[model samples]
Target: MTKLLLINAGSSSLKWQLVNMPAEHVIAAGQVERLNLPGTIVKVEVGHQKTKEVVETLDEIAAIDRVLKRLITVGGVQTLDEVEAVGHRVVAGGTLFKGPIKLTPSRIDQLRGLSELAPLHNPLEVKCIELLAQRLSGVPQYAVFDSAYFQGLPEKTAIYGIPYDWTKKYQIRRYGEHGISHQYLANRAAEMLKRPLSELNLITMHLGSGASITAVKNGQPFDTSMGLTPVTGVMMGTRSGDVDPTIVPYLMKRLGMETPEVVIQELNASSGLLGVSGVSSDMRDLHDAAKSNQRAKLAMDMFVNQVVKLVGGYYTEIGGADALVFAGGIGEKDPVIRQSIIDGLGVLGIKINQKLNEADHTGFLEAQDSRAKVMLIPTNEELAMARDVQRLMDAEK
Candidate 1:
């Protein structure tokens, strides 16, 4: 079995997993979050072992150094060669990227070119790849981008009617994100439902700090709400989703803002649940405080409303869905919120068995009597990445 390492490398932090393939078993997983801060935290959880390391000044280089050290010294990955390959969760594939590409010098340049599409992410991921390749020169790496799977999306569904010249020149269009999670969950939901992937119409909601919704028909993405950026879909942790175009110039003129760049930054970084509640980005915190905090209650209401609207739209877009799958931190775990979302979908003939739904401990989180199922199938992006890596490795062999 070839062991694979998967990385979700960001500009400031890195989330990684090492899995034993063929078995698709996780050997270790960890995250280095809150980059370049005095209270920077590196967390590694393996089986029953969990450790958190806090540092004062955690830059990217230093963060990677600490992660590599832990992988070798603590996590039992003794050598670089012990791992057969690496897979990255690249955020933007644009139209230029269609499928997984072997990480190469030329591909690095291509990824750099795609940086204009994801100014915050692709560049950082490319940096991580460069550093890793330099340090482990002989090892192979591959990019399993969030936008690549959406390539199967219909041209009519993908293209926005705009000036042909503007789109041609700027490559501007909806390049969806969270595709890896959606693809993984869609297949998982099919399996859980004992239905073929092609036979099911599914709506998958990835509702973590950063959220996205997708409409999957016949196993492929039919439509997704997320646009050229992750900041365009349902309300997210700090991102304001689906703002009017006029808001940009309005802020620019009203606030005496010089450039749209900073305003864009504000939209992506300073809005959403955190902005609404003046509370934490976490839904759990908001939910807990909802009893007493008006802001928290309002935040949850807005978040749930956005999700309800998205689910409703997707149901209409896909004609009707057989299953509505929830993944990500919030979607998989938040029962109260899940109930609220599903309760609103009563018109679709979906019902949650209070007993079975609450007792959903296994892969299925559905009410036994419900016609249309609502599931809490945990998203396994690493397993999907490893499967892709396994296929690629076999192809090479």
Candidate 2:
């Protein structure tokens, strides 16, 4: 079995997993939180034991060095050389990459060019790749793109009602994000139902801080909620999911903002749950405030409504769904959110067992007579990345 290190770097944090491939067993998994800031915390989990430490780091390179040292101290590996290869989760591959590929100097340069498409995610991912390549030396590195899964979206579904010449010139089309998680959910749903993936139709919800819903037809991505960027999906922690296009120019004129970027910054950084409730972006916080705050309650209601609307549309687009699969942070843990969204779909005859829904489990939670199965599958994007890494590595042989 080969050992692979999977790296998923976000704007402010770095999540890594060391795994034994082929067997698909995790050796260790953890994250470095609050990078390049004070109170940087390194958290590691090996089997059932977990450890946390504070390291003084001013950048991702320093943060990565600390992670490698901790791996040895925790006995995750005897030496860094044990890690045969590395795989990175790149948020936006654009049209340049249709699938995962080995990371080379040229490929890295191409990824940097796409940074404009995923300003919040791809730049940091590229930085991590460069750091790992230098630190790990000759070890092979691969990039697993989140957008690659939806690269096959139908033209009608992907294109905006804009000028055709503009789309061809600017590449302005729906390129869904969180595709890694959504793809994993679809594969897992197939396993749970014991159905061939090619025969299944699913609506997979990836509701994290950045949320999105994907319509899977015959085991492939048919349509998704996220547009050209991740900020266009269903309501997220801070992003204003879907707003009128004219709002950008209107906000700029009214606020005396010179650039559209200024208005977009607010939509991306200050909107959504935090903007609506004027409270924390977290769902748990929203739940607590909803007991007494009307705005908080409104935010929660709006979130559920948006999710249900998208799911309903996708359900119809796919003709019907065999299963409504839930994954990601909010999808897997928050039973209340799950119930609220599923309840909104009652018109479609989707129902879940209250007892099973409230329980802490990962499987079918659908009621006996519900028209479609409701699955609660925790996403495993790292494992998915490792599998891709293994595939590409073996291909080179």
Supply the global lDDT for candidate 1.
0.80
Give all candidates' CA lDDT scores: 0.80, 0.88
Off by over 4 Å in 1: 10-14, 31-43, 47-63, 355-360
Clash counts per candidate, in order, are 1, 0
Q: Across residues 252-352, which tens digit of lDDT does each residue of candidate 1 receive? A: 99999999988988887778887898876667778888889999899888888888888998888888888888887778778787888888877777777
lDDT by residue for model 2 (75-145), tens: 89999989898999999999999899999999999999998677667877888888888889999899999
Pairs that clash in candidate 2: none
Error of 1 at 44 (Å): 3.4
